[model samples]
Target: MNDKLRSKIIIIALAPIIFILNIITKSYPEFIEKYYSTGLDRPIRQGLSIITGVFPFSAAEFLIITLVIILVISFIVLFIKIVKGGFIKQLINILAFASSLYIIFMIFWGFNYNRISFDKIANLKIEKSSKEDLYKLCESLIARANTLRSKVYENPKGVMTIQGGYKDVFKREASGYEAASKIYPELGGKYGPPKRILLSEKMSYTGITGIYMPYTGEPNVNINVTDYMLPATAAHEMAHQRGFAREDEANYIAYVTCSMHPDNDFQYSGVMLAVIYSMNALADNDMESYKHLAKTYSEGVRRDLVYDSEYWQKYKGKTEKITNQVNNTYLKSNGQKDGVQSYGRMVDLLLAEYKKK
Candidate 1:
């Protein structure tokens, strides 16, 4: 066989190898956690983050744009060659390329999905919390958020604003994890700061706050989001960068890390995120209670919340809907059975932490 054919065969063979590795990971979470997530993955993640962090822009964004261009060009080429033979060969080549990506993903970051659950790692008891527990959590968070909002810098409109903006936010993101790591060593580690997407306004249309690029170990934030939530969004993406792959767990980590951060803006942003989740949970359990609790938000806090809601209202359309569905499917495929609802599930972790306090 020719060298090209041999290479094609080798790439095709990777399919079964990926299958076996997936099974192994699924069946042995402890082994994967010890060896893969904590062991082999560290240098790979750190190395990618260090290399990509040098560039001021989002390397992942550039790579994604480049890949899209390549795909469009490839499709045009295939269409031009439609009258010719070898369609089967081209199809096989496409499949091989896809398999190669999956293999690369497994090597880099996908295996973290199978790592031991964050609850187990953090030694927190996540039991089914009651309405009372949820209400208390909301009450505490709302009061805390109100106080922090008063202290944080605000825009003329009274909306909570990051003082130094994205530049300062990115610089401060690591400090939260630094403080949190003292108590939860699992969260401790040096990683690259998140990069702001150049096309952040476009990213807002998809209703995504932030994204973690596993291939590059970069936390990417949509800078278009309201300022009140930006710090927490950065924390959330950084949680994924830390190898906590589950959405709910990452959300919980974000809150905890932000709570630990020194700056009032970061602290307020984190507490506000927890308050929103807790209030939503309370609303589901008791609307009257939620209404009463909502009234407790301080003037400045209420102002920021109102403006944040309005900001998102402008992006409500088909793009956001489709993105939610796609996001749900993606989460489910990664073992998050509750999918989008898993985000709300962070309230459970919040309540657990509250009870401890």
Candidate 2:
């Protein structure tokens, strides 16, 4: 009944209120589509991105680092408090913090989860694509990738390399989004350009190429990956920054934006990303055909894939598995029923678009 205890109870009460409102929003995707997605979220997302875009470094990354330090300090403090048998106050503080985060997330970007999917916005008719369709898509993408590999610069080892460093790549990436906005105007605005992660090597170990921080509306890219992957990864995160929440749709948008880009490097990167997804689906369907088509990759493309594979191979361990599980759970909690498998849905979008072409 003391002031502190009453405050804790009120904070805990807000959690169920937030949960019920979330359920109401989820039940009416149409309302969210018309009001939140097309109306409120767009302006909110744009305003945050524009404000944060002016900075050279990522505010989100800085916040993350600070949060980590705070967490570490909190654990140390909490341990000492428990040793002193002051557990009640510590528990209340932790609960209050957790509830506050849930509410803040709801206000900032979590409600966007209840909005109509990018599938509806893009009018994509996703279904179980036939094996033949997937195979053809892979073959076509491989050919396109091969053509693009020839135009780009290569390292001494014959692997494709970006002509300029990641800083230049970040500058050029906005052009793709500009082109994409023409096709789907929602993705077209002046958002914050992608920020390179200083801890990109650590990020790569978790299998994350890029991430969109909704808190700051910034797209943070993992530049440690190969040049061919960088452009698409940046574009993909930019897609999320623009309010395309679905992973597959973001990937498709990245492909569209990068392919529409005039630069051959961007074009190749877009095609290469799509090809990888398409080939992956084919591998699951028919390993023999997948191997046969994979064998058709040009020497340059082969070397590039191998290098990319080997780079990731070194990081395949407990941390990567744990991260994957966390990501899977996160996706599921956000209404992605397929969880981590939702990523494979990008292949469906790819097939739908390719069939149209």
Q: Which candidate is the best by TM-score?
A: 1
Best by lDDT: 1
Tens-digit lDDT string for candidate 1 (163-226):
7888989998899999999998878787888999999999889998888988899999999988
TM-score, each model?
0.95, 0.92
On a 0 to 1 TM-score scale, where does candidate 2 land against the true structure? 0.92
lDDT of 2 by residue, 131-152 (tens): 8888888999999999988999
Question: Where does the lowest 10-residue lDDT sum fall in candidate 1?
Answer: 336-345
State, as a TM-score between 0 and 1, how close model 1 is to the true structure.
0.95
Candidate 2: which pairs clash? Answer: none
* lDDT value, candidate 2, whole model: 0.83
Candidate 2 ranges beyond 4 A from true positions = 1-9, 83-86, 339-343
Q: Give each prediction's root-mean-square deviation over alpha carbons.
A: 1.9, 2.4
